[model samples]
Target chain A: MDMDMSKNMERVMKDKQEGLEEWSTIIKPKTSVWNLYIKEIWAYRDLLILFVKRDIITVYKQTVLGPIWFFVQPILTTLVYIFVFGGIAGISTGGIPKPLFYLSGIILWNYFADCFTLTSDTFIKNQNIFGKVYFPRLILPLSIVVSGLIKLAIQFTLFIAFYVYYYFQSGIAPNYSAILILPYLLLLMAGLGLGFGLIFSSLTTKYRDLKFLIVFGVQLFMYATPIIYPMSSIGVTAKEILFYNPLTHIIEAFKYGFIGEGEFNGLGLVYSGVVTFIVLTSGILLFNRTEKSFMDTV
Target chain B: MSKVVLKIENLSKRYRLGEVGSGTISHDLNRFWAKLRGKEDPLSQVGQVNDRTAESISDYVWALKDINFELREGEILGVIGKNGAGKSTLLKLISKITSPTTGSIKAKGRIASLLEVGTGMHPEMTARENIYLNGAILGMTKSEIKKKFDEIIEFAGVGLYVDTPVKRFSSGMRVRLGFAVAAFLEPEILIVDEVLAVGDIEFQKKAIGKMKDVSSNSGRTVLFVSHNMSSIKTLCDSGLVMSNGTVSFKGDIDSSIQYYLGNSKNLNSFKSYENLDEKPGSKDVDLLEYKLIDKEGEVIDSFNLYEEVSVQMKFHIKKLNGKIYPNIHVLDKYENYFLVDTIPENEIPKETGIFISTFKFPKYIFNTGEYSIGLAVTSFPGSIVHFFENPAIIFNVTEDDLSLRIGPSTGMLPGVTRMQLQTKTLKI
Candidate 1:
């Protein structure tokens, strides 16, 4: 053991004398859990942007309506809910216009859903490219988050158009002070969705049964949040269950700021922020671990 | 000597044999049990895999083990091996696509590997978009790609289709575009894995020239892996031979090729069939012994670049009616026949009982690579025949004298007329 240590010391000294200052890259079997390769991800930011562009452009490149489909999807979904849940089921919208209420909740929920589901399939969908090339593995999921953010912005603009249209008809004006919290709400959504997606993406590579469950999982997750219905009508006991859900606070706050119907608690927002931080950190940790050997199992 | 840029030490990788997810829970439990007791992987056997036996008592197999080598700046190292020789494993470890199971690889500069061209190119995207996207995926900054955008387009010859979608382009056009983007990468270290097998012959030559130009003109280091020996001989300055997950030989390009051919193809400079019934030829004439001999009458498989070697064959004829002569066929490593030697009709030997024939290949007449000879003892070409044996015996000629080699073998090897050393078959 002593001889081995002395030999290593001698080798290190010899390497220094040979002027081998530093290595730019070193690959090994077991790296630390916290070595998430953030520097590499930063260097590859351009690739992230390009991937987002490819998703946006290629999705509508062959469609007849092109970018118009982006608006049509939300509008169609809003009408379905108005018919099924509003007119037929006779559910109350807490005195807000049905179109404005459903549209706001739908747009924000779509952003979160897209972030979770798209990134969850990152490793499986990109096996070919990942096997052949070397880049930061986090770039693909990050790109999904960015592209979903852009889509959310567009749909939020549509939501605002409806807000003003209904403002003249029914006097449903947004709370300007509450609207300032919208950016913070979106950040929470991005972080939470990105975090859960990264964890599931790593897990699904090893256990493909999770892939089948995730689509319905996202759908069931939507109901657990305050997307289809208002939080005002729920009982205190039931509301407590929904309050514990981080997404519940985000969706409720987004609605309260938009049409002034749902409850907005500062404590709940802080709780959601803390949850987001925890999930995001763990997601990155799991993602870094899986990226090292996913090619073998994937 | 140049500074070393890439150093691999004690590199190894182990992989599970069967399905990854099937019954993995039990295996994980077993692994936990083993590790808690401080034991090696319970599912794997010890020792390296080899040509004879690879059957393991456990479910895991070591794909690579204890590999070590280094590459200096401006050196082009060609990695050659048969299937399942762990060549791809080594490349994956170096390129950072997959982490090694043990040991480490330290590199000085950016390493770009063209494992497969058009890796991330989407068909729905335009050619211009794909070029940008592909360049970025290969680790080029947007500004760097923009600076070389025109050069890339010109090299790919796709200026007219810049705005057109890539799906409309033919497969050949896509390959050209992909390679053009990578050729302008200007990375300090490059690793390529058989990507040259695609495209037309003309384009393949152009790609090889581009790689050579990069390594030579800019002092970049490259590790190229290919099954094509001619390409390896053409583009690489040094060579590494792999067999069954281990480095079999590492040396100059010529010796590595010789070593690989001799090892993988089971070629030898000598062969003898002492048994009467198990010979290679027909019953009428059977070969007894065949070998290569030097000036001291010593059997040798290898010689310096400028040295004389002789092919000596001994055979016995049980019955012979008409004229029979022994002919020799010499072929290079890629099996291109270099020469065919036979006696004139009048000078042919006949009525043979036991015969020995020897032919001389003069000094400086052959290039530095592996060569094999085919033997035939036959009657008249138009009529009856005795027998023919091909790939009879293989020998290697290597050159350590750098002054003798013109350049990396870019074109045809040296022919007989270039050195002008000729000799006829002798009855000894």
Candidate 2:
């Protein structure tokens, strides 16, 4: 009986040894920080697209207006800005039409705001799904970015309608530089939103106080940027303070390119680009670090 | 020899107790500084064992400690433990939903986990849309989901409500849809955690059948964690039993279950009621000892179908104005009562100081299985229970030569009792 038991044990041991030899994945407490594993994210692109679709389709499902709310939100916000900041507050738009000028800034700002808020709350909002399955965590934030872009596209058409009206009536032609720098401006805004959002999302897992702060902080941040008023209208001291804000250059450059009347400093744009790169790199590092263990705290 | 699909070595997870976000930054910084100075983490050494009921000495506790296991290809491993025994934590770690604080796990092929059903299903989305969404969340590609979409809907039996919003469906329907998507997930390694408990009996049976098909036919590895012993015994080839955040036993299914049930205090088959004061009973009558004895009058917990057994109960009655009958209720492991035998009031003695009553069961009366006995003393033809002790004793009945004569039975038998029938062949 003892010999038979030993033989059984030896056979089991041999099977285990053979099993170990064919192992394909090594899971550990920590993975190399430098190994971003972008290929894994690529493989999950279909899931990312589906998530984006779900967000876009379900956001206003119960509302009567449905997808029309996407158009109504930007239009209503633009009218309020036109009246409150342009007409009532008497904020100058650098000789540009109030509706067109504010609409342009509103569309871009809405996209960035949506991306930032959604991405920053990724860990908290999607903890249920994240805690139950294994996927590239980056897909969640990426889906938000993509959905935000789709919203921007819908809102951008409204801005173009206003731009065309003013362009023919008031002879306001978009400068060549604006068309050339449009892609760069969009990239910068996306980078800044995604980067800062990921950082806050990672931090919020440990410190829940950031959740409340992010909602109010995003509003306060909008006022700091030259979204309501043109950069050319501010005083020298105020301009210097606003210049330090990375978004100031993107908004100002956007107005200068499209409407042909806002401050567009080459150095300021370069500074914003560099800051976006830094924020994005650090955000990704922090996000990756937090994704592995966020469920423990969440 | 089969290939190894997953291997975990020295894996451990530590969690902060009490508060969610208390002093994590300081602890993180302190660990960083200690590591920089070439020392161990100051906090790692202070964590206590994971005992939810006890007062923790430190704010940190190890949820899972030094867990190690390996799975060969096509093997179904059943993980069983009491609540808070780190069963879910082990599944989470294997699923990559959470990482360990120390050690490593090496695995091959795609690993999909169903920690819960309807994980990413949106209430506003239609059943069809949720299928795609939930499928993607489980790591299935769009084409893969599209290929199995009809089958998933058919299996869930929600084809009539395909276009309706998920919120309109019943909870069972939602779970069926969610489970259908997960069931169709053809990952190389599948991890399931108590999800089979959802839905009705028919749905559960279907889901269990699907899981069996997935593992047996596809030659895939499956890790199942459940409190349901019957399902675990039916579906798993090997078993892993965890206790106090560590592995207690790992072996073939029968022995692992034996060790797990043996170690569990509440589920032990042999229970002696030595302390009469602790046993629940009225002051008039108290139970002293209750046990299952064989034909030889020896106390035993296990028996064969051919062996006659008796349930003996010793009691001390202070005063008895009326005749009291001794009753024993026999319930299966699933808490389904099979029989209730009560002694006649005339048979019981009216004047009793210390009395012993034994209820004998003839051979071949009970089928081979585990049974629990609840003891009670009550007045005959009256609805009053004077002294009652629920689940006072537990025992198991195994198949002997007499039972094997009927035929070989693999799973649970069809009826409650196995009776011998006499037959004669008539030649025309």
In terms of lDDT, which candidate is strongest?
1
Which parts of model 2 are misplaced by more than 4 Å? Answer: A1-22, B46-48, B266-428
Clashes of each: 0, 3
Clashes of 1: 0
lDDT of 2 by residue, B1-428 (tens): 57778888998999877777667778888989999999987876444678788877777889899988889889999999889999999999988999898988888899999999989999999999999889988888999999999999999999999999999999999999999999999989999999999899899999999999989899889999999998899889999988778886787887677656655654344343332126546767777666677888656788887788898887777778577777899888788988999886467876868788889998888788878889887764555576677777777888755445556656667667776767777999
Q: What 10-residue stretch in candidate 2 chain A is worst by lDDT?
A: A16-25
The TM-scores of all predictions, comma-separated, are: 0.78, 0.77
State in Å the error of residue A281, model 1. 1.0
Docking class of 1: medium
Candidate 1 structure quality by residue, lDDT tens digits, A84-170: 989898888888889988898899889999999999999999999999999999999999999999988888789879888887888
The total number of steric clashes, by the backbone 3 Å criterion, in model 2 comes to 3
DockQ of 1: 0.63
Instruction: At residue B164, give the lDDT of candidate 2.
Output: 99
